[model samples]
Target: MTPYAKIRVVDASTGRGIPLVELRTVNGIRHVTDSRGLVAFHEPGLMDREVFFHLKSPGYEREADGFGYRGVALTPRAGQEARVEMTRVNLAERLCRLTGQGIYRDTLLLGEAAPIPNPVLNGGVMGQDTAQAEIYRGKMMWFWGDTDRTSFPLGNFHTTGAIATLPKGGADQGIEFRYFTKPDGFVRAMIESKESLPIWVSGMAVLGKGSNESLYAYYAQVRSLSEIASSGYLKWNDAAERFDIAQTFAKDRGWRFLDGHTVQHEGYILGNDPPNVRVRADAESLLKAEAYEAYTCLDEKGEVRRIDGKPDYRWQKSLPPISSTIEARLVREGKLRAEETHFLPLDTEGKAVEIHNGSVHWNASRKRWIGIFGRKGGKDSALGEIVYAEADAPTGPFLYAVKVCDHPKYTFYNPVHHAFLDKGSTIYFEGTYTAEFSGNEDKTPLYNYNQLLYKLDLNDPRLAHAKT
Candidate 1:
């Protein structure tokens, strides 16, 4: 009878399968595990012979036996499966590879080893609000706030709104700046009496609609110093193959603002139906220190219903009147509370950790809601750490934020998760890496005022055992 064995490789700590692990037998035959971390071998002639298996993978350390040899010697049993566990080299390793210089277009223009260093889009500006979507087939579009160079070294610059595209499906490839709203562009074309110019499209949600599957983008506009302005939509024109503000939509009922008060509509959109698409807006009272969020529904008639059921439209020239608001009804039914929508998470010290800009996504594999947010303050002060928290629900009492990445003297803000770009147990996220808000007067060359990408493995023991 031939000796046969089925081998499986998995992370020792988390018990999750580790794919692409290499295994070699004493007979010099080699094999690699599949996506499920499984591989099988059978040898007829060596039925009674003892076999030894060697395991190896990049960025991982192998466990040793009493003799310090790096393999496991085992006697095969017919029709049985054996499991081998491997440990990661460093689960909390904060390492990232800088691929290109400036945006994708700049990288191509200034080939490797160009005499002069490439300048980032609109001078030395950080890429904030890293919103990503696959509008077209296999093409990834990234929208961000182009904080054009500021005259004051320590002050933040206003955004002109820029976009870049990666056609190779991965962000690792070179990027090309597709659309960059100039200082004299439409976003900056209008001037408010007491407000600043260049309203920024800070938070955006790319949605699809209709039979032809046309795409539309809903964004939260903000004035200078991050003041909430209004909410509007943009339509994708197939002829131009670009997005344009739906002027008609904006003209009719797209604007939502308040006088002497801030009511910002920021955060992701959920649900599918056009009439019932849920908008999670982070409402901050700049006058006071109070900050909370609310869930509003966008009806087919372009009416926004507040959580309390009131039509929260500011202008209604020819629009229908809001018959009744849901506020009273929801309160009477005990379905809504004014105190439950606070958006910040608490740290280990029981202190509230303010979240400036981050992403929240449902991780079905982990069966938990994962949120990646930039910490407002820590050992390195504001924007020094990227925190990770999990919860049972999207709107959560997200507690015990774990410090995943520590940027001591650097500022990393607007950490966005690209769930659409996730690869198995490993997920990718990017944030604006700059020294603008770090209190560091000096800027690091080639890395300053650009975006940095990070890879987090969900199977890591630290992340797997993350507290809810």
Candidate 2:
């Protein structure tokens, strides 16, 4: 009967009705016209774009434009319906539509323009059927959620640190400059060392649920007690299957440790080979699987360190070489999914947005939310505030974290985006810090942005806490 909607068509030569002729897209969609040569398809969303539709039948040279085609483009900030027309194809034509493309920079309204969707109600419930662990007074929620069916937003925080890798011999475990993630989604992780001034950063999805749990982190600015004060980029190529933080300059840098040295290390023995073992396995497997390989490493090691013997590899040029580290993982409940490379290729916009802070401490006593701190000006200033939304279930239409607020500072950095609170739970908050009136760079942005992290005080009417 009727497959979709209806449109009109006319014969070019006879200027008469081309009744009964089949209409569809060249990609093999079929539709039938009525007595007036009119037919329709079932679809929407088209504006300022072009499209192609085809006409089909048992063999006459098909005409594409004879039936007249139409197109529509995409709106930068809104969604709209795209009306189109189909033309006959002499050589098998089809209907097509175009979409608008460009960079969109605007102040996203809290309840209206929030970028991330609420996972709890959006069917993004992760870790539903897997083992879940709550640590630090529910500050850290761990579960397995299915991201494939859910919508998750990502964030990028820049920082640096060191990653130690254990080689074939346990004697050598060296550390490199890198970055990682904080439990609270900060891109800064301290190594608890005064002699080494390195920081860890992360770039990954801030909010996710179900089996789709994933994060990307890195350690960087790795240096000795003396040379630690410098702003340089460190590029690391994971293609070498390198893992564990080892000292390439030390005598035993390349060696692995077979026995335990520290009390914490006493338990993990044979089970632990070296940091790079798994990475090497992965690199080899990938090399054997794919016809091509891609990896990069910066000369930022201070001293170029190369392991001897058939280290089992080849070398490739390091693009944007910096002492950057990537930590990627898929947590399947308590079980960890295979660790994949963390550094993702730049997007069409050429901006690295998501980051991870693997070592960030979550002080629930301090606040239920985490604050994302960034410089006031420069490219980072473009970072908007975080927002959170909530709904009753995984299929809910979510509401904003802040019901109403127009203040320039607090509202600017207000928590408005959603992040995974746990496997099945999530919270929404905002980033972006306001400069202090005192003009004190560090202290101002610190207090302004850092203090943004706070629990939804039930008594606080300013926040969009659970109603009723």
Which candidate has the top score in TM-score? 1
* Alpha-carbon deviation at 181 in model 1, angstroms: 10
In candidate 2, stretches whose alpha carbon ends up further than 4 angstroms from where it belongs are 1-198, 201-217, 222-419, 422-426, 429-451, 454-468
Indicate the residue-level lDDT of 440 in model 1. Answer: 88
TM-score between candidate 1 and the true structure? 0.50
Candidate 2 per-residue lDDT, tens place, 319-414, comes to 221111221111223221112112211112332222211111122332332222121111223222222222232111122232221222222231
Question: What is candidate 1's lDDT per residue for 422-447, written digit by digit as tens?
Answer: 66666667776678778888555445
lDDT to native, each model: 0.48, 0.24
Clashing pairs for predicted structure model 1, backbone only: 104-175, 308-326, 308-327, 309-325, 309-326, 309-327, 310-325, 310-326
> Candidate 2, residue 185: CA error in Å?
24
